[model samples]
Target: MTATVAAPAIRVQGLVKSYGDLRVLRGVDFDVARGSVFALLGSNGAGKTTVVRILSTLLRSDAGTATVDGFDVAARPGEVRESISLTGQFAAVDEILTGRENLVLVARLRHLPDPGVVADDLLERFRLTDAAERRVATYSGGMRRRLDIAMSLIGDPPVIFLDEPTTGLDPQARLDVWAGIRALAERGTTVLLTTQYLDEAEQLADRIAILHGGRIIADGTLAELKRLLPPATVEYVEKQPSLEDVFLAIVGTDPDSEPADVITLEEQR
Candidate 1:
């Protein structure tokens, strides 16, 4: 007997979206494997955010089929919603509530048993125990980002969407967020991330897709994408030979010689 593999955690087939006369997505197709990180890359208004909102069931696609955790996002949105969590570009925690209270509030809203225990555990897990009693407004940017991510785990959904989770964080703080994201995938959670940071995507994504002009212009492992473009060696040597050195190395500025502007990284399969 042949064993059957489960469907991808996220699957979108011929997805098309539009607003009146403007098309935002153009028949896009992609799949994300179970328990892996998938990164979406694009510049401003490239339809990257639209994809996340659609998959998270926050918006409806004008035309196409999308499924999350085996549930149809359009027909069975509730099931899709229940199976996923999203930490958007901005932290959505309540400012009036204490860090602990905010978590407990989320836990309670999820109808979990003994929210206190879950709240306390997440606080410790995210290293927020020391500030548990502090109002969320008082937390620093990085701390709030951590707490935002921790809040998304209240029910431990199998899939999570992190939309530029480390956008404005400093280097060390960004690393902390990356560590937390890694931990989630290690625990068997499927993660879908959207970011402009090549390093972050290189470190976390199992696969990547780059969006441009409201469509996916490139998709593949880093090496594969790099192969699509020509390679160049930029060498440096002592010198007044400055112009001569650069001219010898790069030759001419044929735009095609440059790497694709929108680059996202993914692990090689």
Candidate 2:
């Protein structure tokens, strides 16, 4: 007997979208495998957000097709919406509500049974339990992003769209969001992450597709993409720390640790 192959969690073929004179997505195509993170790597105005909106049923494509969880985005938008969660560039958390209140509110909105229980579980999962009752106004960027993500997972959607999930965050806060994304993929959820940060893609995506001029310029695993370039040259030069190194050293240096690793700006030069 022939074994059946599981279908991709997300499939987009020849997707086209336009805004009057501006053509955003020109025949875009890609597939996201189950339980994997797919990064739509691109710069601003590369139509990354356009692709996501179409996939989430918030916008329609002029041509081509997209499906989520085996349901056609155009024909069965309701089913597609049910199977996916979308977290846009900015956090959608309520500043007035406590972290726990925000989660419970989403649970109640989804009409889930035992909303409180669901909220508690998610607070624990996202490491927000300790700050559960604290108003979001006092939460840091990382904490707010975590709660936003936790709310998105209330119904346990199989697919998630993270549009520039780490934009505008400090380095440490960005790492926090990356951790949450990894946990999602570990639990068998398909993630479609759109970002301009190449390092973010490198750190989280199972596959990366670079979009430029409204089309995919390159698509592959990091190793595969690297192969497109000439072999890397190995060489050594005088070692010097940059401003980022100086900043990190100043911010994260230990009181009792040796000062050898922490170089002054003068030394960096």
Candidate 3:
């Protein structure tokens, strides 16, 4: 007997969307396996956000179909919402509230019993336990972003949409967020993120889809995408120091700098 294959966590076919005379997405098609990271890459105005909005039920597609966890996005918005969480371009935590309060608010909104316990658990999981009582206003950008994701997990949704999640983060913060995203996939959550950063896609996606002209122009694993391009002629030249090296030379070593900061700078470059 043939072994069974699990259905995709997300599926879209011929998806189209428009605003008045402006067409945003056209004939897009893709599938995301359960517990895998699927990245949608596009330039600005390439309709990346449009796709995310539609999948999360914030916007309806003008044509075609999309399903999350087997429930039709258009026909079963409630079910779709129940199965997914979304963290948009900006952090969504309340600035006036402490990190713990923000999480507790989400838990209470979710109507989960023992909201305080849930809040504490998420705080600890995200490594925000020490800062849990500090108001978000005093938190760093990375901390705020982490809190946003922790808030999204209050319901333990099976899928997550992170739309340009690290857009404005510093190099260290961006890597920190990337680690959190990987942890999510390892825990069996389907992650669909849209990003303008090509390296981000290359670093995280199990599969990638390039959206252009409001359509999915290419789709595959990173290796498969590379294969579509002509092979480069091999050449060797003297290696030159990168901008990072220049930065390090100028700044020198700071006794106060954390070791992790050095690792983050290297990884980003």
Best by TM-score: 2
Better-scoring candidate (lDDT), 1 or 3: 3
Residue range with the least summed lDDT across 10 consecutive positions in model 2: 253-262
* TM-score of model 2 (CA atoms): 0.91
The positional error of residue 194 in candidate 1, measured at the CA in angstroms, is: 0.8
**TM-score comparison, 1 vs 2, better candidate:** 2
lDDT of 3: 0.91
Model 2 off-target regions past 4 Å? 238-269
For candidate 2, lDDT tens digit of each residue in 152-240?
99999999999998988877678778989999999999999999998899999999999998889899999999999999899999999
RMSD of each: 11.6, 3.5, 4.6
Candidate 1: regions farther than 4 A off: 231-269
Could you give me the TM-score of model 3 versus the true structure?
0.90
Q: What is the lDDT of residue 144 in candidate 2?
A: 88
Show pairs that collide, candidate 1.
none
